[model samples]
Target: MYDESVVPVKMESFSGVAAKSPISQCIKTVLGRARVEKRLTIGLLPAIQYLSKNTNGALFCLTAAAPPGDSATHMQEVLLQAFCAENDIYVIKVDSEQKLKKLLGFSETRMDFSCILVHYPYTDPFSDSQEFDTSVLSEAENDLIEHCETNWDYAQMPVIKLPEK
Candidate 1:
């Protein structure tokens, strides 16, 4: 059982771009039961943060770009948690981007996480914002890593255009 964060670190996210959620959704759609120790968030804006609990979990990162902010960060986390509860997926939240990176690089291949969510992505790190829109990333497309030999009948979709009044 690979316990390490399994999620990737700084995989080329932009100041205005996002990746984590799209990848999470992809894995959720692709692996389903096999997907474990997941990490995800849906910031206050239309953006989201996501991290799968495996080395190959990031195969579905960043389908499109969304707005940014700590509120967005908080919202993302809430949405992710709700999603996991509904699906019975194990998830963790990291507040500091740096801490999040550390877990991703955790030497232990398998270990138990303190909390289902880590609010700090980093210990004494810098910023935790996006540089670009996640939509530009390749993982945004139809690329779900083969963790389990199964398929998800109904996987979540990246936020495309918002609703109109």
Candidate 2:
């Protein structure tokens, strides 16, 4: 039941020693920073809930391509994409779920996640502590924002579709 009309997006692999794209590298850096800051919202349901509850935070969402034949999962991704679009949240589609898990340092655990929402550092007026240093993350975020704004239209969601077996 493969749909020939739906073209799959080009997927990038991070396993080999190949040179990574600037956008990809920025994404990795953002994810790493978010992880260290404990700002990641893992899994589909949790991400949805987080998005629903928080409307004024800087957010980035990463989703992996759904495996072939999993219509339910594919539909869920589509839904998430639509929701993100409406909320102005940036969505990054990775090559695979396994790669995402590895990037988030969850490969050693039994947990599985296809979607991760990163909460970027933001200034809080009421906080007394010094702000977290986010120079690297800021640079990466700026690059990613530039790429997305210049290369793609706002209406187009860059969700990667897994190829058929």
Candidate 3:
């Protein structure tokens, strides 16, 4: 299995904490409880995992291209969906950050979700494909946990830079 150590981390919280705090740790502990076997608490993981592996009868979210015959969305969705076909472990996707960015935004759930398979669709070099598995990401995750080094040390985690072809 991929290193889960990537997700659990301790970030520095600015308020409501003593000089020695583990805001990130609190978030990670709580999130680990919420997550399912390699799945996030939300409904999207199944979707992403299915798409990543190109599962037959692949059910997709709102892609940039094709939509249902009755649905009137965009046109470039099919060509857009094949990018992260290998990272799918769940059958549905929720575009985690967007929903959280608005719903929770500055809430505690953000750090907890640090280990989730984040989708970087509109990033540098690429624009619209998903991005997954990163090193700096793992570092950030580590910063979100409570115990600090013992729980989120670099030695415990291995980073995988997914192919960007």
Please report the candidate that would top TM-score against the real structure: 2
By summed lDDT, the worst window of 10 consecutive residues in model 2 runs over 8-17
The sequence of per-residue lDDT tens digits that candidate 1 reaches over residues 12-117 is: 2333354444334443332222222233322222222233433222322222222265465445556654554454333323233323223344434333221233
Backbone clash numbers for all candidates listed: 52, 0, 34
Model 3 regions more than 4 Å off: 1-41, 44-51, 54-116, 120-122, 127-142, 145-165
Judged by lDDT, which candidate is best? 2
lDDT of each: 0.32, 0.65, 0.30
Candidate 2 global lDDT: 0.65
- Candidate 1's displacement at residue 155, Å, is 27
The regions of model 2 sitting more than 4 angstroms off are: 1-21, 125-137, 154-165
State the weakest 10-residue window (summed lDDT) of model 1: 156-165
Cα error of candidate 2 at position 41, Å:
0.4
- Rank ordering of all candidates by lDDT, starting from the highest: 2, 1, 3
Q: Estimated TM-score per prediction?
A: 0.24, 0.71, 0.22
